[model samples]
Target: MTPRLFAALPVPEIFHKEIRRLQKGVPGARWRPSANFHITLRFFGTMDGKQAEDLDAELASIAMPPFDLTLQGSGWFGKLDPHSLWLGLRPSEPLAELNAKCERAARRAGLEADSRKFHPHMTLAYLQGTPIEKLTRFAERTGGFVTEPWRATHFTLYSSQLSRGERNIYEPEADYPLL
Candidate 1:
């Protein structure tokens, strides 16, 4: 079976301790392990081997300088019925440009255009029937959350599969450096 693939910048470990502190206070929220934390650039879905190869080549061709990104605030996806909690990122033009490059690579690799607009955030947890009030409170309490700016020097192509317990296991397939 083809693997579900995506391009993302892995969260640096230095900030994991602080990030972990905010993982609590929300009941019934399936917290994501720190190891899985990443700011996704583009999700390419399941791709056959040939398409994967083409994508790898296209992604490797991306040329951009490293940029600094800062984590800021917190939010959830669903307004009426909250689905997931996420940590937001401060606006950065370099980040957006990199995302656009990843999108172009996916298209050049024969993947369909992504319909969802790009929003840069690292998912903190997945919510299931989570109370809207609790989600709101979590958002409010963590509104001032911010991290020291981190340098993103490279992006990775990852293949993810559902392991036991339905948790995603992301394995880095390739690393593309920004030089």
Candidate 2:
């Protein structure tokens, strides 16, 4: 079977402790493990070996200088249902350009255009039937969260595997430097 894949910049390990501190206080929230923290550039979905190879070749063609990124604020995706919680990032033009480049690579590899708008963030947790008030309180408490700027040196292609009764496993397939 083909692997589900995505391209993303992994969150630097320096900030994991602080991020972990904010993962609590929301009942029934499936908090993401620190190992899973990343800002996705593109979700490629499931791909055959040929498609994956084409995508890797296309991605390797990307060229850009490294840029700084800062974590800021916190929020949820679904307002009414509150499906997921995330930590936002300070806006950066370089990030947008890299995302666009990834999109172009995907198309060059014969993948369909991604319809979802690019919103740079690191997902904190998955929510299920979480009360709005609890989500609000969690937001209010961590709303002003911010982190020191960190350099993004490279982006990676990762294969995701579903593990029953456990967090999804993400394995890095390849790395593309931003030099």
Candidate 3:
């Protein structure tokens, strides 16, 4: 069997609630639940059972120092305009180091390199029928909004499930504690 999995740093409940609150002001924007908020370190699209098990074992052995992270701004990623709405993560060496550790773990588990630079950000919404004007306006308004900071003590391996709902739901396959 193959499963869609990824490693990420979960956001705290308080910050999650704050993000939901901000979502209220954006017209026609769909919000993701707090439970679905995370800073994705690596995305392993789909892997067989053997590969998954090996990854779990490697992740279990990975070590990382705990760190504090803050969501400092809001932005979007797209060629012509904003496509994906995301909250930018503040600069923290520990956070970057932890991400690197996860990347190493992925390699140790025999996964291929992603080839893309890892920018730490918590995804808030995905653009579907959003117009360019609205996206640009929102980006300009909230580009410097700073959310509260919190300590990150752990990261998890999550399996994503596609649904017809507003946001994608993820299930925790395993969790690894940070040092």
Candidate 4:
């Protein structure tokens, strides 16, 4: 079966609690559980079995050095009416390079080069007609948010399956380790 997939850097388990704490007080926001926290490198959409295998091989061949990443601040995707509530990531050159590589891997796997600029953030929640005031307040309150630094040792290819309750269930299909 074709699997809807993406490449992402999973937030380390240790900081899950701290991340979850920031999800409160946002009305009309369907918060993501800690288990679903990830910073997507590339969203591959749906891929057939052959494409999935090819993508896996392309990603596995990437040579990237491990780097430290820090999560900080909070923000939403849209301006007036928010589309998603997310925690920001401190910019890192290594992280950008890694994302570029993943984009290349997607191209090698015969997918179109993802044209969107990489916005590094872990989605905390998706908004559905959420109040502008509430979203603004949440962003202001968590502006100083910063997590303990973590080393990114690997990136994972995840298959996205829609589970009950409209929540997405992401199953890691492969791990591409970095040196």
Candidate 5:
């Protein structure tokens, strides 16, 4: 069966608790639960069995040095349009390299490049019908929000399954560790 999948960095539990606490205070935003929080290096919409195998093989071949990624700040994607709420990743070479590696792997696996440029962020919420003005003000107020830093040790290849519910749940199909 084809699975909706992506490569992601799973946040540690301690960090997860902190993020969840902060997200709870936001008004009118549909926040992603802490268990669903992750930094997606590449999003592969859906793939057949052979394609999934190919993607997994390609991901396994990617080699990058490990890095400490700081999860700081909250913001919205499509600021004017206001579609998604996210937490920004601090600028770091290792993070960039990892992102590039994931992109290359996707291309090699015959997946289309993500239309949106890779801006490292952990998704906090998805706007249902929130207005941009209020969203912008909320994002601005929380922009500099920071918690403890966490290390990104590995990236996982996830198989996402959609339900009739409000959120999509993903399970790891494979994992590639950073060197």
Candidate 6:
């Protein structure tokens, strides 16, 4: 069976509480379980058995040193369908390099390249009819947010499915450790 796949950096649990603390006051905001938090490296859409193996090999070939990452600040995007709130990440050259590598890996695996630029952030919630004012206030409340630097040593391949509650469930398919 073909499975939808994505490559991402896992958010360490030490920052989970801070992320959950901001999940208030936004009506119609579908807050995600902290379990779903991650900084996506690249989305590979759906891949068949052979394609998945090829992508796995391409990812395994990627060699990069582990780097420190910090989750800081917060914001939201869109008023239409893709409306969502997110916690921002401090930009890192190493992260960008890894993301570019993931993109190239997707291409080598016979998948179409992602057309959008990589913007790293941990998604906090999906909004349906969240008030604009509440979104602004939530942003202001989280403005001073910062987390201690943590070592990012690996990335993972995840597969997701829609659950009974209409929530998306994510499961780790594979882990690719970094140098």
* Model 1 pairs in collision: none
Candidate 6 achieves a global lDDT of 0.89
Better of 1 and 6 by TM-score: 1
* Better lDDT candidate (2, 6): 2
Per-residue CA lDDT of model 1 for 1-179, tens digit only, reads: 55799999999999999999999989889999998999999999997889999999999999999999999999999888888999999999999999999999999999999999999999999999899889989989999999999999999999999988989999999999999
Per-residue CA lDDT of model 4 for 44-80, tens digit only, reads 9997889888999999999978999999998999898
Candidate 3 residue runs with Cα over 4 Å from true position: 25-28
- Weakest 10 consecutive residues, lDDT, candidate 6? 74-83
Clashes of 5: 0
lDDT string, candidate 2, 47-134, tens digits: 8889989999999999999999999999999989889999999999999999999999999999999999999999999999999999
- Please report, in order, the local distance difference test score of every candidate based on alpha carbons: 0.95, 0.96, 0.81, 0.91, 0.81, 0.89
Model 3 — which ten-residue stretch has the worst lDDT?
21-30
What lDDT score goes with residue 31 in model 3? Answer: 68
How would the candidate models be sorted by lDDT, starting from the highest?
Answer: 2, 1, 4, 6, 3, 5
State candidate 2's TM-score: 0.98
TM-score of each prediction: 0.98, 0.98, 0.91, 0.97, 0.91, 0.95
Candidate 2 steric clashes? 0
Error of 6 at 99 (Å): 0.3
RMSD values, in order shown: 0.7, 0.8, 1.9, 1.0, 1.7, 1.4
Estimate, for each residue in 36-73, the C-alpha lDDT of model 5 and write its tens digit.
Answer: 88888888888778888888899999987787878888
| lDDT, candidate 6, 36-63, per-residue tens | 9999999888767889999999999999
- What are the per-model numbers of colliding residue pairs? 0, 0, 0, 0, 0, 0
Off by over 4 Å in 6: 79-82
Clashing pairs in 6: none
Q: RMSD (Cα, Å) of candidate 4?
A: 1.0
